[model samples]
Target: MNKLRLRVQILFTILTNGYVYGFLKGKIYQGPLKYTCVPGLNCYSCPGAAFSCPIGALQALLNREGFHVPFAVLGFFFLFGSLLGRFVCGWLCPFGLVQDLLHKIPLFRKLKRLPLHHILKFGKYAVLFFLVFIGSVFLFGGFAKIPAFCKYLCPSGTLFGALPLLTANPLLRSQTGGLFGWKLGILVLILFLSIIVYRPFCQYLCPLGAIYGLFNRFSLLQIHWDEDLCTSCAACENACPLSLTVQEISRSPECIRCGKCVKACPVSCLHFTAKSNGYSTKHQTCVPPGTNTV
Candidate 1:
């Protein structure tokens, strides 16, 4: 397989099995642990999670019975987003990485590209609004709260997070009702669609990705383009899984910072840059150090 396929498979294996190292005799390893913010919408409830899930923490913050903003959690979210943009989604997220692998299946190909891409991209924001504003605010009635995103949507939480939790805890499973069934149905639908469509959850329903995407343009870590060297070859545009035009927005909200465009650019005109205090500088050469570029 090619490098992209290899990377996707390696990521999948790491996400699924690498966490095994942290578990011992059916319990989490108790050594001094450190947590970092992961970019996509994985759940903190997962037994293997090394870091807190921003969406889960966001809901908990909003659901706090009193007047308290979970500053630490929100701050971490912003800090991670500002530093990495959607790099987590591109390279780190288990779910996003899964979609990347699924989309590579040659049997299921996109019928058309670009025509409806812009319109469909709005769904993720809608999900964010509904969960944060309508569900969290309008419907919050004391501790009797519903994690709207996870309850009604969020397949990642359902499949990777909740299902495992339920399987491991019989008490949690016995308490399940119609709502749980509905969410499970939603998860099943999403999983089925993922086999055919390219990351339907990330594209349409990931609130965390939507939030991080807002900072994509101004994020400290970003894609830099040299307009002088670009031929407008459309190769980058075609390579983008999110269907973004690199020229229009190299750091667009839809751009996951996946580096597909960077690799696809025939002239090697695109690269990553680190920005500080409104100034940008190249951080890494297009090619790895000591590697010869063709």
Candidate 2:
């Protein structure tokens, strides 16, 4: 909801998917940048995408014949997670921007805490484990070379990849069948859910979020909590779309560092900290919940 964050999201989305020629021609870009992975979840199948999808790259590496290690993909995840954690999810992911905009539509009564929030938070991890890691490696081997997550569940691929490509390329449209319809249903369901629940896809399905969340505690960027300046007010919790308890927010892997809680802290007790700041955050100003802008 922050203007600066919104601007950054739009900027990154355009940078990652800036191929006008590819979009016009309805073809995937096969340039040198295609080999490099962007920090957030942009589908490599998108016509305008100039960068590789991180999840797609990981599947390509692991879906190899033997027990070859995906060192490059693993190292890429490590560097990204260690540096920024879910800041990428908060500020860069294209799909995240879609959900954010949908959440602001005011169509339905917004549910601050999504249904079964505590237990459903593990869904992303389950997807990362089963669909990505196991499904790619073992499930559809020999006969088919499909990346299970992208093929079956990635709404980003459906919304960005299938729609544009299918609309533009007749050859691609002729090939669509029950599988495409299934993916379309998934995309529609997720989009509908986003109207009521903020970031339902990020909360329940994105493997990338699961990976980055693991490093939230050890990432270079962090939200520091000042116990001394605390008034035990629950304003931060109420403001947080994910409903993270501010008392242990820094430790929660689910925290996207969206800064809503940071801005909602009435007493300036919560602020961003970098490792370069000697592990201590400054007493930055915070807007009260009533006065905070959307």
Candidate 3:
């Protein structure tokens, strides 16, 4: 409801769904250089994508024969995850934006807050393990087959990435099998759940988001609070998409850098800050405060 929340949401909408605007006008930006990384999980197979998706690249590496762990891909993931954490999910991911919009439907019931929320958060790790470790390593005899993540589990790849590609390539569609059907089913189930719950992928799945969340507590970009200036109104906590209790610690791994808390703080008690080498430099607000201390 605050200016910061509005700005963050608007920025996210623009970045993720900008392709819709371009597509309507019959203009698509397709260049080889767009294959480069710009952070967040934008589907490379999306007809309008200018850059490659990190998860796609990772899966490709894992699926390649004699998989050696592509340093470039891993480096990109680490750089983006460490720098912004799940800020990407909150303000950049196209899929994340899709879930947010679906949650706006009036018929849906918001999830009951549960202890299982904390437990289910670990599901992404299991996905990463099964897809990356067991599926790629054990089943394929060391990544010699198709990307297990894309084939079996990745709803993003199934919905936004692969479906569009299959639609455009009839030859590709001819090759569809039980695996594709399985992934499609998973995608459909997740899509249905999105309308009923908020960010099912972000909360229960999405290994990339899970990885980035690990860095949210210590990322270069972070939310800062001064208890001295604090009012324990719990406004920030209520506003958080991840259901984080902001007063306790704004830097929790689950804290998506959405800036909702910053906007929700009536006294402006919450701020964005950059921390490095144990020194902190505060920025007045979260959405591009213009002071580049980092």
Give the alpha carbon lDDT tens digit for every residue of 167-278 in model 2: 9999999999999999999999999999999999999889999999999888988888887788988888888888788865756788888888888889978888875433
Q: Is candidate 2 or candidate 3 better by TM-score?
A: 2
lDDT of each: 0.69, 0.87, 0.70
Candidate 3 structure quality by residue, lDDT tens digits, 1-294? 345544666675455435663344334456675657656666666655667777777776666667576787779878887787777777777777667777777775676232488788788888777775567654753535656776677787676666766766667779999988898898888877877777888778887777787878767776778665788899888877667786544466666677778878888878777775644464333326566745
Give the per-residue Cα lDDT of candidate 2 at 148. 92
For candidate 1, the per-residue lDDT at 67 reads: 51
Lowest lDDT 10-mer window, candidate 1?
25-34
- Judged by lDDT against the true structure, how good is candidate 2? 0.87
* 1-294 per-residue lDDT for model 1 (tens digits): 138645864665465434564333223323323254455666665656666567776777777665567686678778888888877677667778667666667776553233476787788898888776456655644536567887788777776666776876667778999978898998888676777776787877788788888878778887788776889898988877667777645477777777878888899778777875443465233346787433
* Model 2: worst 10 consecutive residues (lDDT sum): 277-286
Q: What stretches of model 1 exceed 4 Å from their correct place?
A: 1-37, 111-116, 140-144, 276-280, 283-294
What's the C-alpha lDDT at position 112 in model 2? 65
- Candidate 1 or 2, higher lDDT? 2
**TM, every model:** 0.80, 0.92, 0.80
